[model samples]
Target: MGRVNTGPSDPTAPDHHEQGNPVTERVVAELVERSNTLGSDPRNTNFAGGNTSAAGTRTDPVTGGPVELLWVKGSGGDLGTLTEDGLAVLRLDRLRALVDVYPGEDREDEMVAAFDHCLFGKGGAAPSIDTAMHGLVRAAHVDHLHPDSGIALATAADGERLTRECFGDRVVWVPWRRPGFQLGLDIARIAEENPGAIGAVLGGHGITTWGATSQECQDHSLEVIRTAERFIAEHGRPEPFGPALEGYEPLPEEERRARAAALAPTVRGLASTDRAQVGHFTDTEEILDFLARAEHPRLAALGTSCPDHFLRTKVRPLVLDLPATAPLEQVVERLGELHVRYREDYRRYYEEHADADSPPMRGADPAVVLVPGVGMFTFGKDAKTARVAGEFYVNAVNVMRGAEALSTYRPIDESEKFRIEYWSLEEAKLRRQPAPKSLATRVAFVTGGASGIGRAVAERLAGEGACVVVADLDAEQAEKAAAEIGSADTAVGVACDVSDARAVTRALEQAALAFGGVDLVVNNAGLSISKPLLETTERDWDLQHDVMAKGSFLVSREAARMMTTQGMGGDIVYIASKNAVFAGPKNIAYSSVKADQAHQVRLLAAELGEHGIRVNGVNPDGVVRGSGIFAGGWGAQRAAVYGVEEKDLGAFYAKRTILGREVLPEHVANAVHVLTSGELSHTTGLLVPVDGGVAAAFLR
Candidate 1:
């Protein structure tokens, strides 16, 4: 292998000099462009794992004196969507001084404090722990990342020699060392010794490349990755392992999704804590292929691809069996035992490696879960974090494959992993996160959530920190609603016709799978028909009953079943109608079914009370906007009956109510939220009227 110039020759890549001040424009712009390009690709970086920096001169705010400044990626920031404010600026001289005076003991804490203290101005973000290392390099720009290709070679036993063979003297090699002031000093020493080297590969960690300009820095990083890829392709190639499932036929798409949904709750329950949001991931080809490997269980337990991955993925993944045909009860029992063993193993691992100074590990729960037959599942405090963990593990699998193909897969030892895992700096990043919202760890499922009252409820629940599954008759609308309710991996969209029992069951499965389990369910899907008793056709009556009455029964039944299996008490809120309590002229079909649905809630509450499940109903009237019924010409029909114009119908209902306030979709959502929030924990089997105080609808 030989060093080859693979600089920015692609015409399609975005130019970095498009925006910013003249002084730092090229450097800053190039950093942003390259960072986004690298960060956007999961193979390059996951979440906020990578760091980049640029050196420039800025006037000192305190003394108005010209000072050299290093802008480094800030802590807890994502590079793909980074902005100017995301980079923390520090005086280069102050950072270098810490290198000379800082004691090695408690280096992590001291370096973090020193970084915070050396901020160029008030309110500046904290620089990454690698900031000092970025300053030591003489280049105008620096890029540090944990790309899969680089990690594959970095974790190999002969990685150092191979790196030298690939790039000759173009890149330096740094032995594994815990990241802190000492690591920074070591990197500086290597760079000084090899003045001609443009980059350095840190064994068992990652790679760093620097240059006089942003373009050169990015080019060198890309070149390093290319050389590693080429070397792996030629020398270290794995024999063909055959197709992922050579003997077994793949499950149909629908069946696969259904199986995932059924098994998701078990993973979620095992991974969750009292205070964590705990989002889940179970559908990906990479995960399936990894699971299909004959040595999957052993290979997955080897370790993470790199040390930085230990912070998110842990030392090894927790492997479990999830056959598609496994009984739910059996699956639950096995998962319970697996969880216990996993925790014990984690405890033992920590005990064996921990020093007297190490802080007690917070929790021993597994972040990545490998389900042999079904696929892989990753858990996090929220959807985005869970997805990030999944991404890292997927990349880990690829890196491991590459390493095994070339040579024995060799990662940092457990002691080194413990150092990074329990490092105060990494832990502080998590600590600095703001307190979670009220419904942080809760999961909710909402039917008809694509729009109207359902959509409002979904959004409100998500805002309060619940992972939500938006189910509707329209798949496109459901997906859109889920996207709008976005918090990476937290919300999912499923097309579900509530009246269909199979569809309802599938939707519930999806809810369980995506969020580990469902805590709150909103039965808000229904249609309205206005017809006199004498004029009502059998089809009209059946359609109304199937949806409002039978639909509620099916959804509630499935939700209760899952909740029962989870052994956790949950809330079920049914969206009934004010007309259910008060008779409305020419509305027999809609009103009668709604009344039946309301009574069903009381019956369910009575039956489920023993299981600690609460069933309640919300009676909302005259929700003119954001209502499917209203948008489907019900507003005009109701207005005609009242001898008012279509546009005036909303006002007409408002005047008829005792409070004379407009009843909106949001008003209904607030009532649903209250019931699901367990604020009225002691109360159940009741209906809350959210119709601006309708007298007849009031509970007697």
Candidate 2:
């Protein structure tokens, strides 16, 4: 098993990563542990959704005087992976003092800039917008969390009355307000007025709890959340979402997934109209349950109440109009019209609320789409984002269930959602994100990707930010190769016999669901039987042609069909060999199939040009070391033909080349990247040789 290396800076054991003094060190250690424990479970917090802090005294380096500091979760850091480095340590005295000169809620965005001056010496990380909430709360330790159970009570129509009934005076209730310096000050006042209260439910938001000690704070946080969950279970009404729609019930597991796969490209295409997007399909029980309910459409239209959620999931989802049991073709036919209607509705919403100072509409495309029988499909610029958005929506569904069980589910209105979605502060945060890699929004499929040249090609494309699907005849090895490359969001492995038309279609379906659709493909699956025409059996010729020439043809045809559905131009590259043009002894079958593959590249390029699909080829020579074809016994046979040992064949072949240099799998992979990099957009029917200067194999 592989292990992730953790060191001094890592806070796995509180003592390993310490602070200025024993007191400060102990507090910091507990803060990190509490944050990680709470963050690990989705029940406590969503990814990067909550904030935690510990207030303590630290020795000032220059003055040698005791200074009050606040160590809080910082911008863009997840609580599950919270380390000392992810915390922003600032002078509490300075941060609190800013309230005296505060310019009010209208100019609250300026207060974030002022936070820089409050850093205690060198700040650990940039303080998040929630810093004020943590700093101003009257306690040694504080937590601001968005637990589904807590949010349910927070967003209920009779939330204040229900909160009083649930916890009595232990947890008070605060009304809705956009988080800022003013909200922080407001929470501080509420805490002071209620001496018996341990926390407060922030209406239309989440929960906030505090304690004089770290353990007390965490215990209080969990107690509040657990109590809320139990209260809902005991007192909540049955069938809160209303009864299931008869024809919209979830389908069987296998059929559900198949339909999800079939519809992925069309849904992804509609979602990516403004810009290319990666998709995630979710079919959890809760998702299906919500979709089947009659009240879901009405609730989904109102959107999520929590700021953390709608920011990732968008203001609302695009619910499918047709029934879940509708035929695949029928659903596909109606999608275009449905997408246009959603776009127009979004445009009207923007125009109705946008002012002269508001930023231009970012996108009209829907980020989430609901399919009753199938599931939910969410889109983002990359896979991780898409997956997280889906998770947030699930949290929203749970909240709605609990809220509706208690009373009417009344979330925040559209005006507030609009203000937060297009907030100037939010825009600045987006601008700060790092630029995307060349193939950031692209997905690639590599044949024979379990080993050798195909594996190299898969790794190369993945490094450039393309989601990769490794397809090979060996199912086990294909999955292993994918795991080594990255997580499921970045890569997946599938077993495929490229020459079989049905198998090829199934593989394409997998790709469509895994990542909206394919943007690039490399046809590199092949094997060689080194024998003269007279000595070669019919089986040898058939195997070579089936895997190389015919296999490339089938994969290309299927990929092209899916790409056309996506309405996105794509790339198809064939890893042909130099022997396609050069004749050599005892290589009749291998060379003939390569020649067939080379011709297919030209044929497809001419035919696919109208669709903006670029078909190209990379021809390599003497890939002896680290080659799957050679490892399968071709190396020994080729050595015998040249009167040399198996290991010496590589050196012999290299010495004969014009440049006397060896060619490796990576060199061929580089040529594929060059062709599909979008730099040579107009270049097709082109073959680049990675043969170390082979004059005989050179294209005329």
Candidate 3:
């Protein structure tokens, strides 16, 4: 690293962080506001894909003298949600001193720890790898971003000449270099060497811009991106990817979605061969167009250039070789063969790169998979990770388009990519994440999840870290329930009448699309028509059994197929009622249906045990409060039958139990969690009673 001599610190600098320094406070606030404006749009930067900084004078509490402070985005934070607390506060004078003892690129890892000594106070947040970039730059504000249009130019074949043509003298081109303390020093020199330059394109990486003001820096960053985009548009071929394959032409929307749903579980399973993973599906025009073209296989094989994208999506995506129009059965079978080859190739890549110091081959499985016609599916430890991985790949696809238009898409070599993928610093960050919830990475599909016991079950499972699907007859109510559970990515709602086969399949498909495939299924959709045998019409009998009995049957069958295809063992819990065992008056239709479901649980458990599908039941007697059945007038009818007030029916049922406790939805939810909570992995096929000790319904 070339030594950059620093002058003595100015003790008389304005204290930006003074208790009453409004100007300094305004500057930091404006810095955050600029970051949000840029980060809010995916075009500006992908989620958590960039860092920004501002330099100002701050009062040193210990010395009572003014000092220059550098505030930059910290490690593991997204720019859009960045706050003052999210930035690392460092003494710029002390930071410049590190150039004297950087020890070169070979010892870069040690430099990260060395940053601790330069903290201005306790240090707002952990300093990121790009800290030196902001600190060494000779500007008041700096922005380092990875926009698609900019990276497309960065990875072009003749990028140096093209960058000159694109931005003239304002934006310069720097050769490919792995990011580190030295890379920052290199950028600093480039900025100093070139006068009247606003930014420089980091070859094979991204773009960096600087300005005397925060607004100017932000403007330069956006202008660089928009300029490159316009250049690519003007000079690039209309169809850089070439003609689409015969059978790979983008499938019709409905068919495309159906095929993606059918294949998601198998794909998710393949990705999880190394560790359990959730899946995310995407079929944007760009991704589909790329996959349909002749160049996709070759381009995808080259892998992504930017480290931010590669870390999330891995070295390269695993591609499906057969045509999209092939028979579903044939394609599914062929996928297995191709998957074997992909695994072998990935393992070889690891063997080719590993050394004594390299982290153990993290996993051979690819994080992203591309299928022509159908679309892209990405997997990770949880829903958010999976979704974000897809977003990063979209960035990768955009980079490819821009690069191909300029010339050949030339990304950084694979050897350097391997080093970063297994970098020790990244491993440390993973270790720092809080322990996962009990049901982390598991997907739970809850039927009738809109209200009552089903809603409670969904909420409880979500709290334990399971991604929930609120499937119910009421679409709006289902969405409401899902919203309360968590964010759209964490929990989703779908209208599903479990008794309809097509509707049931579509609901499960949504699950596969939203959070991979099902690991836990709650067959809880139900209704009741309390009537005596003579009064129970044929319609009444059919409706009751269709939901509880037939609906449970349909959901289990579809879930079993998905789970079996995934090859990951799963749990299925049926919410049977206490009436299944104990006969109740004027309840012929509802009681018989419950009895049918109770038996189905045991029968399926015995048969599906070979496939590692555990089936169980939760029998709750009088769940009246917040109960959809009660609210629908069942409480009045049951109260009339028991000779008690409508509201007192709950008390009447509770007094009958040995424990004298009214059964609530949460109580039933707890039983469901217990059955599938992994603590009782061996205890399946057993019916757990949540009826507060009803002897009549107790098993022998």
Candidate 4:
């Protein structure tokens, strides 16, 4: 490397001149704040001490030539409170070019020449060691802080390599070197190479990344530190630490159950994961208490697990005990509001970067770090969870320590960070694998498959490689439907009235004989009566119940028998209706029968949960759009019953949901697909809302 001369003065001394751009000003300001904080520390930290700088193009009013250098603290000044005037500018390109071809020679002369080339910006001090690297970040705003966690990681042998192995694909890593123009230029080159990289791990240094906005840059920094902390926790050798948090306890069972039922779906919607570790710390009393028992006490030693956690949980948690002066409902309500805000912000971010090929992935959590007395909670979707929290705690300590040991830490710039945050390529890597398409070769029987949702579901199941038997009231229609299914080798059509036990039993036998053994059963065949509650006669109720409710019971019992006899777990899907809960107009008989379907599915799920026979229901909201039901003026009747104009029925019905779109047969089919595909192996007794946002209206 070319010799880069250093002044006897602190290399990171600040400059008084105003740098162009608001973003740059803000970044410089944060650096100044960080520097002031560090200087105040008694240790008088160096590289481990805080450092700050400005990079990217600034047309020199005098020379018009771009002058780039890694800027840092000048000799005598404590960076803790260094202002722009304290900044020292240097020429980084000159130093890097010299290092490119040193020819195993001494570089003292080159260093002297480069030093002479440095500009003091009219009475400003000479550039710091960080000038060169800072100059090369290419982002208008660049802030570097030595988080303790990063320092610890860097201090380890092969820290750079290890960091790379942990966060390699997600972040860039650069080798450590003296903080100067040569290092800055080399890092700049790396930044240039990775135009989309959000941040980088400085091999033995810190982290560097840019942003179009300060918040974006800050977010990048937080994410990088969090990722590093997680890595160290998983891979770093563990040393004994104090106890885990004391007085810290899991949420009470009743409150937890109530909250989970009300909020977990929202959580799952955001995080999109079934497995989660939720630790509830009621008060600040437990924040430090956990350290005594924790495997790694260092994580608990700090106020926030890591620097970035400040964004999620605000530095530290609030401490409290039970008898919480606040009402339970009030606490829950506040948490719900926070969740909404978090999701809204996340959505805004998505909208800003969404494109045709890659629409943004929506997260369900409100990202609040729940602190009861100090109410806060974090929602992690995908892999973030507490995993990120634990990692951030440890990594921040490591980096902070390292930065103090040296003089500064380095990371990628903010613009680069933004790119990575919004990168279509990176986003593609984080998608949840799709639910399976079909139930494979599992055999299924769909009663009333001649038409409607049952037929549609049967077609879908058949398409998914299921051996489907189309059982219907009309034998000819059943055979025709089977022929249309085109699963000649796997599907068979049979005539049977589901409400008739003998007929259903005979059909079951024929299907089992045909497909070896039945594995799935769709209890969909049904009849409906649209009488008022007072108008609903006993006979009407009996017919609807026997067809919709009892039929499901009998079919399920037989299917379970077959599944258990074959010693293979199976899935059962029931076709229910939104009317089970949402009473629409005067259809008392239909509503009553539909409610029974929901109960049947739930009962089956509860009974068969141990038998390994999963039961689920698809409560179709409005499948009339592409069906015979729609053409028969049912919409008009529904609109009339709901006291709405017929012309605005779809929009009226749609108003009940957040998605505001009419439910489609395919949408219902998709839900069925999940239930039957084994993707929902752990899911049972659940009613998945296919209603755009209608259910949400009532839920909120």
Say which candidate scores most in lDDT: 3
In terms of TM-score, the best-performing candidate is: 3
Q: Model-by-model lDDT, in order?
A: 0.78, 0.89, 0.89, 0.56
- What pairs collide in candidate 1? 236-406, 265-516
Q: How many residue pairs clash per model?
A: 2, 0, 1, 121
lDDT of 4 by residue, 245-339 (tens): 44334345445333333332232222222222222111223322232233322332233322233333323322222222346566455645654
Task: For candidate 3, write residues 1-700 as lDDT tens digits.
Answer: 6865354222334555674588788778988998998888888788998899998886777888878888889987889999989999888888998988888788988999988999877748899999988888888789999999989988999999999999999999999888889888888889889868999999999999998888999999999989998999999988888887888888999999989999999998888888889999999998999999999999999999999999999989988888889888887787778778888998888889988887787788889999899999998888999999999999999999989988889999999898888888988888799998888989999999999999999999999999999999999999999998899778999999999999999999999989889999999999887777898899999998888899999999999999999988899999999999988899999999999999999999999999889999999998999899888988888898889999788899999999999999999999998898899999778888899998888887
Q: Which stretch of 10 consecutive residues in model 2 shows the poorest summed lDDT?
A: 1-10
lDDT of 2: 0.89
- Output the TM-score of candidate 2: 0.96
Query: What tens-digit string does per-residue lDDT give for candidate 2 at 1-700?
Result: 1111111111232322224567668888999999999888888888989899998776676776756778999988898999989999888778878877788788988999998889876748898888888887768889999999999999999999999999999999999988777778778888878979999899999999998878899999999999999999999999999998988899999999989988998999899999999998999999999999999999999889899999998889999877888988989888888899999999998998899988889999999999889999999989999999999999999999999999989999888998989988888999899899888989999999999999999999999999999999998999999999999999999999998989988888888888878989999999988998799999999998999988999999999988888888899999998998999888999999999999999999999988889999999997998899899999999999999999898898899898898888888889999999888998999989898888999898
Using Cα atoms with residue i matched to residue i, what is each candidate's TM-score against the true structure? 0.91, 0.96, 0.97, 0.37
- Give the distance in Å from residue 640's predicted Cα in candidate 1 to where it truly belongs: 2.7
Off by over 4 Å in 4: 1-438, 628-636, 643-652, 696-700
| Candidate 1 ranges beyond 4 A from true positions | 1-21, 61-64, 105-108, 240-255, 273-277, 321-333, 354-360, 487-490
lDDT of 1 by residue, 1-700 (tens): 1111212222232333221346556656677787888778766666787788887765555665656667788877788888778889887777766755677645446877888767777664678777867876666688888888787777778878877887899988888877666666677678767879988888878888887777888888888888877877887655422345443333566776666677676677677643344656665776777676665666777878576577778878888655545676786678888889889999999999988877778788889887655666787777777777887888887777766766667888888888888876767777778988777777788998999999999988888888899999999999988998895466889999989999998788777667777888899998887778898899999998988788889999998887776666788999998988998899999999989988998999999999889999999987997788888988888888889998888889999998898898989888987887767999899999888888877777
